[model samples]
Target: MTEIGEVIELNRFDETSQVDDPDLARALARRKATFGASSVLFYDKPIHMASASGSWMQAADGTRYLDLYNNVPCIGHSHPAVAEAIGRQAAVLNTNTRYLVDIVHDYAERLLAEYPAGLDNVVLTCTGSESNDLALRMAEAFTGKRGVIVTDLAYHGNSASTTAISPGSRSDRSVPAHVRTVAPPEAFRSGDNDPGGSFAARVRGAIASLEAEGHGCAAIIVDTIFSSDGVYAGPPGLVDGAVAAVHEAGGLYIADEVQPGFARTGDAMWGFARHGAMPDMVTMGKPMGNGFPMSGVVSRPDVLTAFCEMHAGYFNTFGGNPLAAAAGLAVLDTIRSEGLLENARAAGKTMMEGLRAMQGSGSAIGDVRGAGCFLGVEISEPGSNRPDAAMARKVINGLKERGVLVGATGPHGNVLKIRPPLCFGEAEALVFFGAMEQVLAL
Candidate 1:
């Protein structure tokens, strides 16, 4: 069996695979020559996408595929409001922070309002990796410690510093000297009835280990939804004990909201809020600008002050530019106008209940978990909890062939990651569920 937290690099078509489409073959050759080892195309026979709108994406061959995998288009694909805002701002001015920009301030104020009281200051970045990297620095500067604790399967970012803390990204599962990893809050697999308490105990142990190593704890950063750790969202307040432990150890709790923010979790704007845990710092991305490449870190003013005083002030050339700010504002407006939060709640409930019903029929589904638009369906061996990556791959490809798009994620790569646009409705949900049933039957 593959080790837990190991990223399953799905099978991709190589030169040996027989290709009938000449254009696709040429495209694949060009991609290989250009991107080399870094090129990762989804599906065995990759679909060349032409365009996308709302919840539907069209392939180059004119086949329409229902998008159940993309979360970046939080409002919807090619949303007119966001596109218009970007265009209007780009045509007028697209300068950096060197200039006095009201739009930037306006967007910052709007975003900060969604956060809790103490998390007032905002530092925009170009991606979630950059936001997390900066948050780590702030924690180290404020706490005067070097150690960080994260979940065993966490994938924070791609930067050197962030990668040091993201064990999932590392092939060897090795972490830096200043980092320690704890088990995720997985209720299904855990023997203990009190999953929260069990998780907190592991966190405390990691803290002790870090302290003993002379690297006092700086922060306990986590994806509040634990998306990569099999999408574990608890029975409300499941993370309370863990947060308290971090606080008692004088460590900040940094919530990586890249996967669960922007009302993706249905009930709240931020995933940590779902558990009633207020993080000292929150990093957001993916849906911030509705796929306009914007991200930010929200922290208390005192924490920002300490970090800036200790080091040079921070700035990104493309972060929070006028165009990005406009797009972000437009996304926020669309969410309100469309009532996307309520839509996500309703649509997610339908999807979850449908999946649970399918599970009750004694299928290969070992578990169905998550909230709102973000959900995970674990494929496992029949009569056992053992993960079945082969089944997951089959289901993913089967869905693709049937004009539905979904992806595989989790420690063992057996969980179907279903996160569509916030605009996903009952009609779209029915399409997905019906297609899923058909695929499973096959």
Candidate 2:
């Protein structure tokens, strides 16, 4: 199996290789020249140019592809409401968070209204990384501890502190002494029995390990869905044990909702709500502004106050700008007016049923799991559990060639990650299956 955080070249474009399409070749060369080795592009033959709308993206050559992998534009690409709100706000006023802004409060009130009681305050940030970084600080400040526990393949953010806790960020770097890793609560791995309790026991062990090493447990942070660990959404209350274990050890539970928030899970507005886990702090982003770069942390007032009292105070120049707030407000309005929650519920059910059926008929699909719009189909060697990274790559590229877009995740890079925009519907789901069938030779 591939190591966690190891670069899966199977799913990435090779820079030194070749390009047949002159237009695409020229574009790739130019990008390579400018971005150098830091550039990360998907597909072996990357498509050039793109404009997108609703649930589809058009290639530079004007070919349309069904979108099944983008989660950033939760309300759909180029949504008119969000675009208009952003345009209107930018044309009128876009300023720093230092000033009092009515629209900011309006957005905050609407956003916070969905959160559980005592998660009464919100601190806006420019990205999920910033939100997680701030959350780490808050947990330390509140608990006076220096340790964190996370799932083995978890990816919280890219900041230095978050990187230390994110095992999937890199296996090259040794985990910091204060941070410990545990397996995610995926049902299949646990034989469909007591996966939740197993995950909790792992957390408890990690907490003890941290304490034994002189760093008391400060927090247990998780995405709940475990998207990077191959989309492990589950039977209800899966996170209850882990949350209780952390709390028992005097550690906070920071729910990193960057992946599963804003009704992506269908059953609830936030992923943690599905399991009824109460987080001491919750961080969210990506879909907050339908791709407008708005992100934030929410916590009880006392928890927030604890951090502020220990420092010069937290602030971000562009975090809660009126423009971002307008975009966020538009997203909220769209989710409500479009009935995306109910759509996610219904559409997700259709997808789950379809994928499960696909699994029964094919050896390539080892497993099918996830909730709502976020799901994963594990690709495996025929008649065995061995991971088939090459097969996964083939399916991904094959689907792409047939005008569909998806992604790969899991340490083995063998699971097809199928998370589309919240605007995804039965029509979009049907398009995905049509492409999947052809790709799998079913």
Candidate 3:
């Protein structure tokens, strides 16, 4: 059986699993040669995707798989509006931040409008890692502290600084000297009556520890949905206490909205809003440009001004280019015009209800929980709460074999992560539920 933290790592290919197909084998060999040791392919038999549409992806082998694993294309995969906007802008002008671009300003205004009142400044970046890296710098500069806090299994990003805070990247790795890890608000397993208070208490403890260690807390960065920590978005206000604790300790709250932003939660544009905690800074990516590479940090003007004054101005070569801004604008416009959020809420509710009903009969299912379109189903022992990563792996592979695409997450990697595009509707939900039912039944 695969250990909790090791489940995801076990999905990668090893020397034993050799493909019989000559084409796939050649492609795999070429990928390995080019990508080298860092190459991490999904599943034992990876799918060579040829194209993707609204809720489906076609493999090079001509197999169409329902996509339930992607949140990056919030509106939908290959959205025509986004593609056209990018094309039009690229044809006209695709320059950096140095140039005066109306599209960049337009996107900034539109994106900033979605944030809370005080968070008016936007610093665009090319990826979530860069946004988070900037956020860490701002927090350290603003607080003059070197310490940061995160959930035990948190995954912020890939930069050197962010990697120190992202334990999910490698659970076997030791927590850095400047970072402290706290238990996530796991109401399901912890069974704490006051999950918010419990989480807050843990944050306070972590802050005290940091202070004692002479690295006073700088920020508590968290993925509001806790996507990497098993998708815990329940017990609204779970982070309220933690936010207060961080503020009280003169630390900032950096909401890593890379996974839950852009109405993926079906409740708000930002996940911090749903938790009722106002973050000092909100970092967003993934779905910002509907698959276009665009990310940003929305911060208080005062905080941003201080950071800018202290460390000079910040700029990214392709951060707020005309093409990116155009793509972002089209995504926002489509979200409103198509009512994707409402669809997510309705479809997600139906899907969750169906999963819960299945749980009543599925012995392997231990829990069903989530918010809006982001949901997680935990696979566990038949009569106990012990995580069954083996079962989870089986189910994930089974789903893939049955033409459904989903992934596993959580500290134990026993939770089925079902985060599809916001455009997923009743039809998609039905198909997903049917596939899930079949997989679980097996």
Cα lDDT, all candidates: 0.89, 0.88, 0.87
Q: Candidate 2, residues 84-172: lDDT per residue as tens digits?
A: 99999999899998888899999999999999898999999989999999999999999999899988778888899888887776856
Prediction 3 TM-score vs. true: 0.98
Off by over 4 Å in 1: 4-6, 11-16
Q: How high is the lDDT of residue 334 in model 3?
A: 96
Q: Each model's TM-score, in the order given? A: 0.97, 0.97, 0.98
Better of 1 and 2 by lDDT: 1
- Each candidate's root-mean-square deviation in Å? 1.3, 1.4, 1.2
> What is candidate 3's local distance difference test score?
0.87
Candidate 3: worst 10 consecutive residues by lDDT? 1-10
Q: What tens digits encode model 1's per-residue C-alpha lDDT throughout 1-442?
A: 4455345465355556767888888888898899998887888888788899999999888999999998899999999999999999989999898788999999999998888799999999999999999999999999999999999889999999999999887767789899999888887655568888888999999999999999999999999889878898877887889989988999999999999999999988889988977899999998999999999999989899999999988989999899999999999888888999999998889999998888844587888989899999999886678888888889999988989998887778888989999999888888888888998887
- Model 1: worst 10 consecutive residues (lDDT sum): 5-14
Residue-level lDDT tens digits of model 3 in 134-162: 99999988999989999988888899988
Local lDDT at 405 for model 3: 88
Return the lDDT, model 2, position 106: 98
